[model samples]
Target: MSVSDPLLKSLKRFVLEFRTTNIVVTDDNENLAKLCSVLEEIFQKGIKKSKFFDKSDFFWSWVAKLPSFSKERCNPILSMVIDTVKESKKVTLDLGRGRLFIRSALMKKVLTVPVQIIAKNRQLAREVYYENDSILGNEILAEILQSLLFELTEAHFQLRIHNASFLDRTWNLPIYKQYELVPCDNLGLHVQYINGFLLVKAVEPGSVGEENDKIHAGDVIDELHGEALRGNKMSAVHNILQRYKGLPVHIHVIKGYDSQGNLYKPIHHLIEDADIDIATADELLQVKKSTSNGYKKPPHTILNEEEAEEIPVHGSEGGASHEAHYLGYVSLGIDGRVVRIEDSVQGVLKNHTQRVPVRIELTEKEVLVIDIKDNKTLLQHAYTEISACGRRTDQLQHIAYIAGETSCSLAKKFNCYVFEMKTNEEARFALCAIAQGFERTHLLL
Candidate 1:
């Protein structure tokens, strides 16, 4: 989100060092005033450095219109401005009441510590933050840094990881190509100390180390920028690299661990199955109805001869059909409740050869059904288990008619009218009711 403009960079740098520490854009330009207002807000809010310029896009566009404000002539100044923004405590220039102040008390303290030292520290902090990407830094420490250094979480401090590139026979080492125009500052390499000694834990892909096929996992960082780095912490190595950002530096490494293993791996996650059924609505309603009748009726098996004769072993295959998207199959309990949902419904369906029988029912808001794939003859064999205490057609929220073959092997098509349920609880209750209804309706064959 940086401006990437030279004149603005130079202006900022000049303001940073100006004795009076006040920048007053004398021109009666409204854009200039608007620019100052944004700078004030940025100082107060202290947004992340990467997103700082996002809110000032229009102001930077105005800078582009300034005469003779070419980026090439002021490249070095731009670099300086960028470096200050990254490392310094807050921006050097402070705009307030239509005036800019540069020599803030915080800026004075940082200036006392040589620019290179501050830059090196900031660079190391940035790298460490990226390495421990998921963890958040301490908020109190962040305020103290004033944007110079963000505090690290304790978790990152515990892990020992070394980032080093190695040259070996297993990796076909190639001589690094020379780039005459731009200095080879970013070799895309990082080094570290794992265990007690220096160990190379990571090598970025497509970097100088990886492309040259020189650096590999398990390599020890022997020296950095010509200085021996044995037994040194990764922070020390970061300091060395920081001072030579745009320069080519040689790395000496000793082979250690095998180069065959991957340097880094992705984090894994575990998915859990949904727990569906808990209680049934019919049982609850029966208990309520029994309580209202003055005395609790002893639970007894019903022997309704005429009603029992109507029970069919299996649902008729030839029924009214409807084209509807099949969401997935669900299991219902005795009182009409959803008990379980398949992990990969489509996957199971695709592998299944035969149509899975399901008894459908309706809840207060949604439709509920049971996948009878495991119990092919549930309608016939399980008919005797359930009690026919009571039946309420008004409680039935929906009627899902069999529309097509229930086998999952075929492509998905609308085959049933699924009644809508207001909530998951209603669906679960409805499922249980339908399950009980199925048993009550089936014949004992």
Candidate 2:
């Protein structure tokens, strides 16, 4: 059998959307079955044949079994088909840590078949309820079945490529490069110890470290004179550098940014004032101004009456002041003697109930909370460790709170942290960003 002209035309339009060359359309059942099997393989093993409407009986039975067919419940499947065919609506499906979206009329028609079959069979009761010509014929159905197979194959292939691109852009392993520097008077580099890594905080001009074009402020000094600098204190690193003064020191460094402009993960959290150049400083100032504008009042409210009266309002005379309050959050260190807002959610964190004021930042792999006053890192949780996050409803407008739970590896316990943002939009943005980060981490794995 051959496909009818009407069905062939419809199928060709769908095929053209994928821009696939060497088009072939036939009504051979064996070829159609092979195509369906290929689609199943592409989607991975054990995908139900009914998922793509490969079997005629299964398709009909699925329509008959729909809860919407009982008239009391609404049929979302039928509604999706109608919306997709008429308005070119698309539907997203979660697939292996990524998402797959489809917006084809032919696929929608194939999805609507079972419902149409059930409705027609019900109306044609007491008579031979054969397949209707208006809905779908056998030959045309074969062509559509083949078309859907190709559509899904192409869509899945594109989704894989997209996910790979995302992984390439977001998650990058640290690439180490070696540089041999001969100090004249000094190495002329200011270094800081952060999370057990020695980071080049600044490179003085006319120094060997600055002369080396590849070295930058955020580059990590992984090794010095073939000795690992990790887990070494600043004094130890200083002693090593002094021992090798005026001598060629072979060191291994992790570049802050790769050739393709991908930043190292550690650079995101360890950025300091010295790392900011003129252009970057201007950009950061603009961002700070915008963030400060979001909250006309302070980001946190003191629940204790005595503390509230004692502490003056921010920007008022004799008010408590600190650097980097750009986001309107109080810049209290982790151990500062400030009374914090009590957490509304119980048992989120063991022996921790106070919602401390801090600045929250999200990277591609982890969420970092930094003290706004001392710039100390209070919490760092990988996305894999974070089980879930969402907004808390007990707060007032413009005072959005977010809570996330992280599983501790050493203690084998869950620790929950709650953050307060200036606006509801900011809270939602943080929640979505974390969710996307979590999904990307799993996709890479």
Candidate 3:
């Protein structure tokens, strides 16, 4: 079971980096071998980049050797895998964590789900020991990262995308005026490269009449608000976001295919966000801004569309002392506060404003801090340049600095949690890198 836990985690981690690689888990040895052959045949774009000779090793010892506690601590997922092995000739991997094993014995192929991967950190035991100075040790860390990545999986859910807006009393009729804001989730535009043709990652929550028919994750979206589909997904988004800022817009989509050849179209809705209560939905509708609501007050500062084109570097910071890998989240210190929503579980029940998810970069003791829009100016005097604060030095142990806020100790804001993990110089240095990495890399809203 110990090995099972890490293997699952490792598989999850591997999948994130190599998303298009088709994976098939089987108890049969021959089937596993055939999978490798198929993988080399179809997943060729960068198949050569990821092939590790030992990647397919099914040694039985690896199954019970998780790095966590000596005793078995992984159960839920184990139960599921065991059940899957008990039945079925094959299995289908859901986009999320749970696996569906096909059982033909039942009249209809019964999809047996025995394990579920929730989106939460389940550090089975204490943090694993790692020398900060170690090389970008994927091997030593592969199992750990793999285990962790699987934890980030969750069941599919809906993303109630509505028009995003800002309120302002400065323009139009008193009730009609709004401060123009960039189209966020509400901005009737979205796209993610899956099977290919620059696509939009949008869908109606419930199986609506016909819209549901066209929605699917990998569907190639080839159209943009009447524009002939040209360029990639990000390009289309940049164009639409610039024009639709602070306005109501409609979007149309179709299934798309990648240059390498994979296709998917929606026959059902794929939910992808936190849940909301009916009352919250109703309230949101009442406050929903529309074309008639008047243009919203313009935002004072916004992410420059051009800047996004520059990111997505698959490599790490130039020749750092140690190696780093892309974790797929944008990290930055916007000027904001370290905030915690009070009674968010219940408060968000009717007000989704509280349910919007964001990441808090963690410190040594696990204290989280982030840059929000407001107080970021605090970094102005204390530092020059952007909102984050982490300067690396030769020694692996160093104090990660904070951007802005010259007058206060950014470390103090975390209270007792701040110093909990700074037990030694090495720990402090690791924490510094983590703090800065989180701020500079976390995705900004």
Candidate 4:
């Protein structure tokens, strides 16, 4: 309960040893082993901890990479954890499968207990070091704490998305299975070009595309307005849309399906060709022939002799830059990371209850459409109300609150739209129209 508690003490010791002394304990490190044991006990013996592993990437990553871990570990551990949690009565673990979360007053306290102790010591050490240069402690303790907190934040984000898996499963699946119309509003739909195909990523909920079921995530756009979109970059799609601003555009899409006509779900397949040890005689022959024909090895390929050890190859879900204005009001990082939809604007209906795609990048510039799932309830509130889009021309200091906070809040009532200006002065007009249009429609109080 207190920082002086035995569990907290052990946690602090582990952190200090992990950061300061590096005598190379690795998998055999007693401190780390003890820490893992403690975590295992908490997960197994503590009934309230059952929801910690549900769809958690951090938990899954640890389970996948740790020794003596298996799916079987879950059932018994979860059962015990539940009982322990119920008996203690100190913390209440609400098993919310719909949101895929374990909510308890003690959960945060438990996770942060170790970090808090280390952080306090770290701050003291920092002050001591400033006064006396010989003072001890790792300089990177703050970074470590920050990293741990970030992981917690990311894990929470993942859980929310997993709980809201219905949108993609029920509504969006139809569009990918059969042909559907994707609405392209005044801003545009979010998309990414991958492997010579353009796929729709997100759509605003109340927008024409979403309301009419014109577009859906995972539908591959093969052509736009009779022109083949294959092999073209996202810029090309932008260009074609800009060229014909208001015309009824015809888009041909390759619905997600297999050659067998079975519905295709997104999957991660192992790279059989990447396995060197399991090559057959025919495969060896092909490799020899290919080598003889002047095939050069890839640049990053290291000779086996120069490598210290073989690093296991894992397949990635893939990554790409994503943006969508057509779906419930959402925006992404220019680099394509999913930015929070609710934070984008007011009245845009920010539902932290749903799951939007967090980044699942494979290579630096590729994204597999299947990797992104469960995004319907996200930003569902702001579909039809957006009246105008605009860019903030003010200083950066004045922009965050005005653009992100003020404008979005205003949009909820007036249905005004504001967007980052990209060589277009139209959004400014839209902002003005929002005020004028509202005043014209109703007498001011």
Index of the highest-TM-score prediction: 2
Model 2 TM-score on a 0 to 1 scale = 0.25
Q: State each model's C-alpha RMSD to the native.
A: 29.7, 24.8, 24.4, 23.9
Lowest lDDT sum, 10 consecutive residues, model 1, at 264-273
Best candidate, lDDT-wise? 2
Indicate the worst ten consecutive residues by lDDT in candidate 2. Answer: 302-311
Worst 10 residues of 3 by lDDT: 163-172
lDDT of each: 0.29, 0.41, 0.26, 0.31
Please give each candidate's TM-score: 0.18, 0.25, 0.18, 0.21
* Candidate 3: segments with Cα more than 4 A from true spot: 1-281, 287-292, 297-300, 304-307, 312-445
After superposition, candidate 4 runs with Cα above 4 Å error: 1-188, 258-261, 264-445
* Residue 381, model 4, lDDT: 20
TM-score of 3: 0.18
- Candidate 1 residues 353-426, lDDT tens each? 44434554222222234444552322211212221111112222222221222221231332322332443334
Ranking by lDDT: 2, 4, 1, 3
Tens-digit lDDT string for candidate 2 (215-257): 5667777777656666678888778866654333456676665
Is 1 or 4 the stronger prediction by lDDT?
4
